[model samples]
Target: MGLKAFIGKLYAGIAQKQIENMRKNGIGLQNKTFQYLVNEATATVFGIDHGFANIKTYEDFKARVPIRDYEELRPYIDRIMRGDDDVLWPGQPAYLAKTSGTTSGVKYIPISKQSMPEHITAARNALLNYAYETGNTSALDGKMIFLQGSPEMHEVSNIPVGRLSGIVAHHVPIYLQGNRMPTYKTNCIEDWEEKVEAIVDETIKQDMRLISGIPPWCQMYFDRLSAKTGGKKIKDIFPNFKLFVYGGVNYEPYRARIEESIGFAIDTIETYPASEGFIAFQNSQKDKSLLLLVDAGMFYEFIPAEEFFNDKPTRISLKDVELNKNYALILNTSAGLWGYNLGDTIKFVSKNPYKILVTGRIKHYISAFGEHVIGEEVEHALMKIAAEEGLDVVEFTVAPQVNAPAGQLPYHEWFIEFGKAPADLKAFSQKVDKVLQIKNIYYADLIEGNILQPLIVKVLKKNAFVDYMRAEGKLGGQNKVPRLSNDRKIADQLTEYILN
Candidate 1:
């Protein structure tokens, strides 16, 4: 191994030991984290207002603070933006992670000095754990590319503000700076297509062994590279390419096309990260679920997903979670967010070490007919059929079609973009519908009761989703198309791209 690889291996060893300790003491560490956050923020305006000083246990904390989304917390966030010190967190925030919100338009999530390092550490340890488990650190010696938002930032009350991925770009460890690709100038381009073109120009000939990005954007990069190289596979361009690290969405739907572009299969690590906090990461290659980051300066809570919208939902801690049940994730972070609803749903796959699978978004689902189909269930059903039929799905979405033509029953409409269309499209649709029914019993009952028809598959012309996102001005950088929607807002717009 090279000097850099050897150093990485040593660091991985130390990180692995720390992770083992965390696994063994998951519940204890979470309790400690909870106490530390509550105690540290006692003097802050939000803390004082919520009676944080009197909170001695989880129940006490819950009673003192009610669950809040970004909109509800905006009043406190406004104070911070207006130059208030010790408002939400201790003193002023080091940075504000700017992100798009569905209902709120834009959100500025604070990243405190004490909390920022946890994000970087959790990301670093994910790779370190991968290296330690696989005994492969050679990727550290090669060029790496992280396709992310522009690192440019404006100031709000003297705090640097930018997208979470862009803010993270500024913190790439000094040691890895030399190995990072696509010069800073290329990364700052505002237009995603133009930025991707510049990236291709800069790194097409370089040795790119580690590539990281959301799966859809990464697929676009692969397509651009192939065009630049006259249809050459990604492995042909970067022969040393080995590890792909990704998050933000499920990768299974895009797996076939990505591997085909790469010319072969490669090791991948999945991470569950967000602007609020780094939540989990895949610790072992053999395990598909991610190990929850219980000790990473954040305390977690969960509400049963079915009861999430109730007037008074049951909120439980890590010790109370059971395997295979979906729950809406909540957190109290060192970043000064208390009783914050993350809006993501997750299911515990392994409780011994507290591993989880991100199931879906709380607001992103289809239940127009009382058949609540989630992102995980749709992805699972689609990918299963795609694998069996040797089909390549580029992108897809599901929405309820409440109104149909005369004498037709209401049904789920699937908008699918295929890299390679199936030989028998009708048969393929039936197979997917059968699988989905098996996965979601509610959908099956709706069909068997004659309340709905088997799903209708609508083929989408190539680049349909890409075009839809572009039209909506959300083409790249952490933005993703929702897998399922209950209404026809998105479905109505998608009609223009449907194949005749």
Candidate 2:
């Protein structure tokens, strides 16, 4: 191994010890994190208002702070944006992570100096853990590309503000700077298509071994590269490519098409990161679920997904969580977000090491006919059937077709963009419907009761989803189409791209 690789291995060994300690003492670490955050922010405006000074227990904290989403927390954030001192964190925020919100037009999440290192360290540790377990560090020697938002930042009240990925770009460890690709000039281009074209031109000849990005954007890059090379496989173009790091959305639905683009299967590392904080990462290749970061300067709370909207939903710490039960994730971070409803639902696959799988979004689900189906169920069903039928799906979404033609029953409409169309569309649809039924019993009951018909498959033209996202002004960089929706907002817009 090279000197850099040897150093990386040694660092990985040290990180492994820390990880083992975290696994062994997750509960105690979480409690300490809670106390640290509470004590650190006790003098802040939010903390003072919430009585953090006298709060001595989790229940006290819970009773003092109400769970809030971005809209509800915006008042405190606005104060900080106006240059107020000790409003959220101890002082002013180090940076603001700008992200698109559903109801709120734009959200600016704080990232304190104290909390920012956790994000960087968790991501670094994820990679180091991979090297430690697999004994592979060859990718570090080759060009590594992280397809992300622009690194350019503008300041608000003298505080740097930019996309989470963009902010992270400015902090890339100096050691890896030599290996990172896609010149700063190319990265700074605002238009995604132009940026991608520039990236293709810049990296096509480089020895790319580690590529990281959201799956859809990466797929676009692969497609662009294929077009440029006259249909060359990704592996053929970058023969040394070894690991793909992806987050922001579930990769299962895009797995087949992505592998086909690459010409073979490759190792992958999945991470769970957000504007609020870095939550978890896949520490082991054998375990698909992410290892929750208990010591990452954030305290976690869970509310049963089914009871999330209740006036008094049961909120429990990690110690009280049960296996396989879906919970809406809540966060109280060193960044000074208190009782923040993260809006994502997760299921604990293992409690010993605190491993979790992000099941879906709390607000993103299909229940038009009283059959609530989530993102995981839909993705699981489609991925299962696609594998069995040897089909390759590029992208897909599920929505209720509540208003069917006069004689037709209301049904679930599956808008699918297929890389490889199935031999029998009807059989494919039936198989997916069956699997979905098995996954969500409520849907099965609805179908059995004749309340809803079997799902209808609508094959979309090539690049349909890409076109839709572009039209919606959400082309790339952490933007993704919802997998399931109870209403027809997305379905209505998608009609324009439906195959005739």
Candidate 3:
């Protein structure tokens, strides 16, 4: 919060303003603003440096400084370690948000008061902008709840990586010096065993409404709320809770259970927040997935899956982005990431510059046994099969344990917990296997020859994943379920006890 940092943030705000101005240009960028943006882009392209301070043209930036990844800034992190202004951006960053990438590995994303507004701005655009344009803010009246990570800033860890919890912690309304809860903060449970109890306790204490967070966690919470309140349904406890905002992972399968638990189909809003950026959120009631917050504080770029590997990889600017096209998201935020691959793919559903859809995870792709599968495909198949079985399913995760040779079973261990188990297991398994085959062609071939084994649904004990996360110190706050696995390893380890 020093003057130098203030100046840095001032510059960032100005830079952010210039970028947003480009969006209003419509079809394409106007020449003046475009040139100005390119100039700003060149100087802060990889963060401000006196070494390249004089550079003024986009072509000069391209010719001199090539596109780089997060690792290339090792020297910058070293400078940050010394409290020097070697890192990108103008200010000295204050805190780091410890967050994990799509991969299990973790990184501490750099955050400063200046750069934090990007999150605030994106969130405002998500709510205020939509409300102003469409008169939808009225839905958020009464107590608003955000199912985000705890605001306890970790004292250690200097590596700067972006994650949702830290970002959520950074921007949430704070009226207290202690824990970071929403305005109507009450006695919340920090204990794993007592976490759901605490949520139930708080819900009953206040006229609670307006819920937000990942689907699995939110669903589990209200289910516990319904149970603890004796007969008070979630609809009653949260009568004013008009919108149930969800993000963090693919939510198709869990939506039905959430609606069922609440005993009513409440408003469901979707968002996509990551360590890299608050990529997109539900603008209108019509949900196609992530609607890109184009007017955010960053330069947006997209590279298709096929061209993502070229030496001189090509990218599509915001104005040039095509509809119905799937491309990897690359972000250049004021916090200092330039040309950074966010490890997620988005399909542009409409030409609305501010709206787009999250198709799938670029890193969540599981091909452990040559059966290429994405989260959505697996999710749809499971939902369909579960529907056929007539069971209320809570949460499920898929992991491929083995690489099968042709005609051998490629084990797909599914951990599923249901409100009520289906009367018949054989029929349920057959339906699940068929769902797999119809969804993924490679898996279908694998199943036909027994390369991938018949589906196995291990009905978990209720609130099992929640208990596990609480045990890991990751429950209640901004923690997320292990959505899709890169391999079968984590899914196996987490569910090993209950599976047997």
Candidate 4:
């Protein structure tokens, strides 16, 4: 075997063994991991203050450290940024990953030496797991283009502040860097447009075997490639392109357009990697579920989504999680975040193997007028309808339009940017409304009681969200249009670009 293929097989074997060990040990290993983390962090100020040394049980840890969001953890992160040692982790973080925040603006997430390797390892294992499942070692032979964020790192109190992708890109193994496309200089181009064009120019003639990126950005890359290569599909340009690895957004809506761009079906792997930590990855080619990274240096807890908004919610461990129940994720990582609510929700598909599907973000929902709707419900409805109608939906967002003036009632408004529109717009709106009503009883009750009007659908000009995101300085890399809003904020903004 070639060097790349040999390395691929070796890594795959290692990854598969780790996955199997995780599955077999599962809860016992998780508890031990938690105890280890607690012991390691006991010397830190935050840990010592919380009595981490005396906390031998999960219950004691939970009682000592209350669940918190990024806002609550910001002060400790700020202390770390100011070169404080052992404020949260055992020492100062190596970098501060700047993630987008809602009202708080930029959120600086700490990345210590302990946690950075975990991120890198998780990313590597994702590919290795894919190789193990598919037995396609040839993927490592050709170039793998990771359409990622700008590598321009800014100094935040002597620590780096930049996108997670860029941070990880710098840490890409020297061996794999040989087969990775778009040189570091090209990736450092801060302007996404310039980066995309430069990447196309640099790698158009190379042998590309794998493409890994967020679906929206990947679509843009594929579109540019197709356009540049005389209307040829991605496969036509790079016939050996065998794998598409994606995360950051639901791939369902983008799947039709992605396949069209590729001109054929290909293998895919999904991942649930966040700046907080790399959480899960699709391990089996046969199942669409993702195996939870139980051994990945992070302790996990789940709060039932139904009770998440309550004054006191039940928090359960990985062993206590049930199949097919929506739960908000809470994480305690070696990176110094204790009981940090990642703000994302997920449901377990298989407990034995510990597979999960990301449901939605905690605050990403529309509950205005008591017609509660989550991102997962809206995405599923839209994906199903778009498939049935043979339409290609690129992106979409929903918000409540509460002030209907004097006599009219409030209704949900959907702003969609479609690659291909439905034949009947009115019928499309009706179908979407029906699905939401069926999924959410509160919404159905409102409609039946004549308290709310039927949902409204407005097709926006193509790239409307792209334009909005650009104006907001959030054009690429992990920044996505919020799927649902409680108010008319996003809807009103999109109305400016609506096609009528």
Q: Residue 173 error for model 3, in Å?
A: 5.9
lDDT of 4 by residue, 18-37 (tens): 88988888898799889988
Model 2 clash pairs are: none
Deviation from native of the Cα of residue 168 in model 2, angstroms: 0.1
Task: Decide which is better by TM-score, 2 or 4.
Answer: 2
User: How well is each residue in 89-204 modelled by candidate 1, as lDDT tens digits?
Assistant: 89999999999986688999999998899999999999999999999998999999999999999999899999999999999999999999779998999899999999999999
Q: Give RMSD (Å) of candidate 4 vs. truth.
A: 1.3
Q: What is the TM-score of each predicted model, taking all chains together?
A: 0.99, 0.99, 0.79, 0.97
Model 4 scores a TM of: 0.97
Off by over 4 Å in 2: none
Candidate 4 clash figure, as a count: 0
Better of 3 and 4 by TM-score: 4
Which window of ten consecutive residues has the lowest lDDT sum in model 1?
Answer: 99-108
